[model samples]
Target: MSWQTWRTALISAAATALVVGLLTDTGQPTHPTTVAQASPPASGPGTNHAIDDPLTSERTRAWREDRFGMFIHFGVYSHLEGEYTRPDGTVCRDAEWIKRQCRIPQAEYERFAAEFNPAEFDAEAIARTAKEAGQRYIVITSKHHDGYALWPTKVNRWNLRDHSSFDKNRDILAELKAATERHGIKLGFYYSIWDWNDPDAVHPSTFGRYKERMYAQLKELVDNYQPSVFWFDGEWSTDRPSNPWLTQDGEALEAYVRTLDPKIVVNNRVGKRRLVDGDTGTPEQTIPAEPVSGQLWESCMTLNGSWGYAKWDNRWKSPADLTRNLISIAGRGGNYLLNVGPDARGRIPAESVDRLRAMGSWLVRNRQADAVHGAGTPGIVAEPDWGSVSRKGDTLYASVYRWPGAGGSLTLKALSGFDVRSARVLGSTQRVAVSRSGDTVTLTPSGAPTNDIATVIAIGVAPPAPAAIGTGTGLKAEFWANRKPGGTPTVTRTDPLVNYNWKYQGSPDPTILYSGFSGRWTGFVQPRFSERYTLTTLTSNTVRLWVDDKLVVDNWQDHGPLLSSVAVDLQAGKRHKIRLDFRKESNEAVAKLLWSSPNTPEQVIPTTQLYPA
Candidate 1:
C-alpha cells in the first residue's frame, strides 16, 4: 500500500516509537532475535513480553539474536505487477496497495486473486535462499488488508484453495512452514487486522460479526499453521476518515490470538489505540539513528523500490549497499528484515535472489561478526567513514565498505582503556597492523579489501571502550526565575551538562524560578582536531547560542519541543567561548545540548573541555 495508507493508519502510534533508517523509494507515501541464552537483557516498550515472566523475555532475546530475515510482501496485487494504467497514463508505484490507491472496486480487486496463479512458487526454494542468505527467519503475508486468505479458511470461501488456482500443491503457508522447519529457520505470518473485503465491515455494529469471522480465521491459522511470529498491520483501519464507521477490536483480537498461541511473537500493530507495546517495533523503510536500547525494533525495506512485484520498477539498490545496511542495522542491535516481491508466477524476482545470495556470501565469509548472540551495540568509534563497526564478544568487526586508501590504514578514536590483542581480516589469512596511542587505535591492513560488499577485520581486544559522553565540563549558568532571558541573575550554579533532559514539578533550585524562567550559560569548548563542528540544542521554548561571538544557533521563538543546530569550523587545542540564552515560556522547561564533529559522534558536549567564561 502507499505510505499514505501506512502513515494515516499509524501516524498516531508509530510517531512515538523509534524507526531504524531504511528507505523504500516509492515517492507518494505518507505511511508510515536471538535465541535466549542467559537472562535476556531488558527490552523497551516495543515487545509484548510480560517482563514478569522468564520464558517470554527469553523468547524476545531469541528474536533479537536472529538479526537478519526475509520480508515477503506477496498478495493478489502481485498479479497486476504494475500493469494497471491510470487515466493520466501514469503507472502506479505501490503495487501492493494498488487496489486501495487506485480505488479499484472490491470486485475488481478480488478478481486479481483468480489471476494470481503462483505455479512457480516453491516453499523449499524460498526457504533455502533465505537460509543461504544468512536469514534466521522468514515473514510472509498470510492475509493482507484486502482480507484475502492464503490458507483454507472456513470463515471465508474466498481463499487461496477455493478461489484461486493455488491447489494443494500450491498451498504456500503450510508448505513454507514445513520447509522452514526442515531448514531450522523460523516462520512468521503477516496478518492484517483490518478487512476491506468483508462486506459486514462497514459500521461498528457490523464490526462485531466481522471480528468473529476474523477470530475464526486467526484460530484456524494458529491451530494448523503454527507460525512463530504474527506480524500485524492495518490496525489503524478503524473508524477514520476513509471508512468513518468501521471498527476492529485489535487488542481483544490480539488477546485471543495469544490464547491460541501465546508463544507467537506479535508486532505492535495488533491494537488500535494501544499500539507498539507489542512483541517488536516494525519500522517500515527507515532505520533509526541509534538502537532503541529499551525496545525491540526492526527496519523493513524493499529490494527494488516496491514492496510487491512491480514489473516496471527497476530501481534496485546495489548488493554492496544492501550488505552495508544489514551490517548497520545489526550493529545497532536491531534486526534487518529485507523484502522481496514475487511475481504472479510465485517466483522471487531474479534480482532479489542475486542480492540475497550476495549477502549470504558476505555473511559466510564473516561468520564471526554475524553471530546471532553476544553482539555489541552500535556507535563504535563514531562510525568511521571507511565503514562501520559490528561486535561479537570482545572483537570489533571493522566492516570496511569503502577502503580508506591503498595504504591500508584506518584510525579509531575514543577507544580508551582497552588493549588490542590482534587484528586480522576475515575471509582471508592476512594480518593487519594494530597499534594503540591512549584512546586512539590505528589499524593498518596488509592491503585493500578483497570483498566489494564488505570485508570485515576482526580486531580482538580486551573488552570494548566505555560509552563516551561529550567533551567538556557543564556550562556555567545564571537564571532568573520569574522573568525571561533579557536579563538574568536570580540563581547561579553548576551541574553536569550531558544528557540534560530535565523535568521538575517544584523548584529545581530555591534560587531559580519554579515556573517561568530565563537563563544564560557560558563556557569554553575546544575540539581535539581542526574540523567543522555541528552544535545542536533541543528546547521547550526560546533558545539562542553563540560560538566565540558568532551566533551559530538562533532559535528564539515561542515554540513547542524543537531541535536546532548550526555548524562552525574550529582549530584544535584552541578554546572557543560559547554562550547560550534560554527562556522558558511555560511552567515546564527543558534544554539539551548536543554536538558532532569529524571525531565526535552526535552526543552532548562533554565536561573535559568546558571552562567558565
Candidate 2:
C-alpha cells in the first residue's frame, strides 16, 4: 500500500513500527482505539499466491468460512494483573509487559513460572462459550514472552508442567485439545519465537541453540496435537538489535512445519510482520476506518483496556461496539479474533461472556448480515442522513446504526444504477415499499425498528446494469502464441477489469495456464491528480505494467506472484497510456492490476476509469 494507508491504521508510532499501536507500555493511548484501519503489510502474501493443492485450498477455504474466532491471552501475567509498583511510586499499568516495565532480573522473573496454577481453566467451558458466541475457532497462548510454556515439552523444561507446583504432571495443551475435540471445536496455539529467558535470545553466537529448542517444541506440539492455526509472535525484537539471524530461523521453521502438516494454517507474524510465507495478515487491535480490499486480514483485539488480565483495566468496549466491529469486519471481508484474557484461576470474565453472548444473539437474528460465503465485499455508498450499508451477493444490508428521525426514509446514493427488487426488515417476512427519484433510491420500512441496538433492511438488488456498447468503455485483452506481440492475436476479449485465478479455471483468459502464452492489455487511465500513484501488480509467473511507455512495474517471477507496487506521476482528468503484459510458464495463472493514488482508495482500475487506447 501507499504511505497514507499505513499512517491511517491507529495511534502514535513507537520504537518498533506497527500498523496499529494502541498504546505504549506506559498505558497512554497512542492513537484512537475506537476504530483503527490497516492496509496490507508493506509486503507479504498476496491474493491466493500460496502453493495451491487440494489440501491447501480445502484448509484455507474452510478457515475463511470459519471467520470468527476467540483469542486467549493467558499466562503468568494474569497472576500479576499489572501490580508492579515502580521505585518512583507509580504502578506499571500493563501487567503483561511487567518483565519489560518492572525491569525484573531474569532469574527473579523465572520464579513466576512455578506460581502458574489455573485449576479453574476449563477448556470445555471456553470452547462452549466460543460456540455460543458464534465463534468457530479458538487460539490460546501456549507460550508467551516470559518464556513460560502452558504445556509440557522435552525441549523446554521451563513449562507449566515442569515448573508449576500445582499440576506438574499435566499438559495444558493436551487437556485443552481433548476438551475442544469433545465439543467439536477447532483449536490452535500461539507460540512465541523470542524467548527472553534463554541465554541465546541475547547472545548471537548461541542463537543456533535457541532455534533448536524452538523447533523441537513446535514439532512436539504439532505432532502431539493436530493444530489448525499457528499464531506466531516474538520472532524478533525489532526495537532493539538482538540476534540478526532470528528471521532466517523463523523462515526455516515455517518451511519445516509445512513438511510436518501441509494443512496447518500459519499467520503473518511468523517472521517479523510476515517476512515469510504465511496465510493471513494479523492486525493487532485495529479496525479499518473504511472498507478494505485485495488481501485477507484479521483484527486481533482485546475487549478491554489490556491484552492480558489487568484487574484495574476494566474499561471494556460496549456490546454494541463489539457486535458492530464483528459485523463491520465481516462486511469488509475479514475476520475478527476478539480477545479475552483469563484471570489467574483461568476463568473468563463474566462481563466478557455476557458481551459475547449478546453479540451471538445479534448474529443469530441477522445471519444474512454475517457476510459468510459472500460474492462481494461491501462498497462504501453515500447514504445521506441515513444508515450504513453492507452487501453480500445481490442482497444489500442497510445497517441501522442511527435513526434519521422517528419515521423517515433512507436515501442511498450508490444505488443509482442498481435496480432494486424489494426491501425487507431482517428477521421479518413483510417486504417494505421502495421508491426512486433521479438516481436516488429511497426505502421506508413497514414500521419502526424492533431492536434498539441495530436494525438492518435487506434490499434485494436486480442483476448488474448492462454496459453500453462502445470502444474506450472497458479493458481489452489480446493474446499471442509466441513470447512477444507480433501480427494479429489468436484470441481477443473485453472485460470490466483484470481479475483472474486460473487455478479454478484451469486456463487463463485467451491463453493456457502452461506453455508460452503472451498476453497484453491496452487502455486509457483517467488520473485524478498530478501526484505519485502506486500501481500494484499481482500475477502468476511473469507480469509487467507500463504507464505511458515507461515501465512503472517490471515484476516478473515464477509461480503465484506477491503483491508488488511501483510509483508514477500523472495529472488530474488527463487520460494516460496504460499497458499490462502477462506470461504463463506453467501451472496456475492469474493477472490483476490494482492502483492507488494520493488520498484515493486503493482499487482495481474500473471501467469508468479505463478506456480502449
Top-lDDT structure, candidate number: 1
How many steric clashes between backbone atoms does each model show? Answer: 38, 3
Candidates' RMSD to native: 12.2, 11.4
Query: What is the model-wide C-alpha lDDT for candidate 2?
Result: 0.65
TM-score for model 2? Answer: 0.70
Per-residue lDDT of 10-41 in model 2, one digit per residue for the tens? 22322221122122233332221121221211
- Residue 56 shift from truth in candidate 1, angstroms: 9.5
Give the distance in Å from residue 236's predicted Cα in candidate 2 to where it truly belongs.
4.5
**TM-score of each model, paired residue for residue:** 0.66, 0.70
Best by TM-score: 2
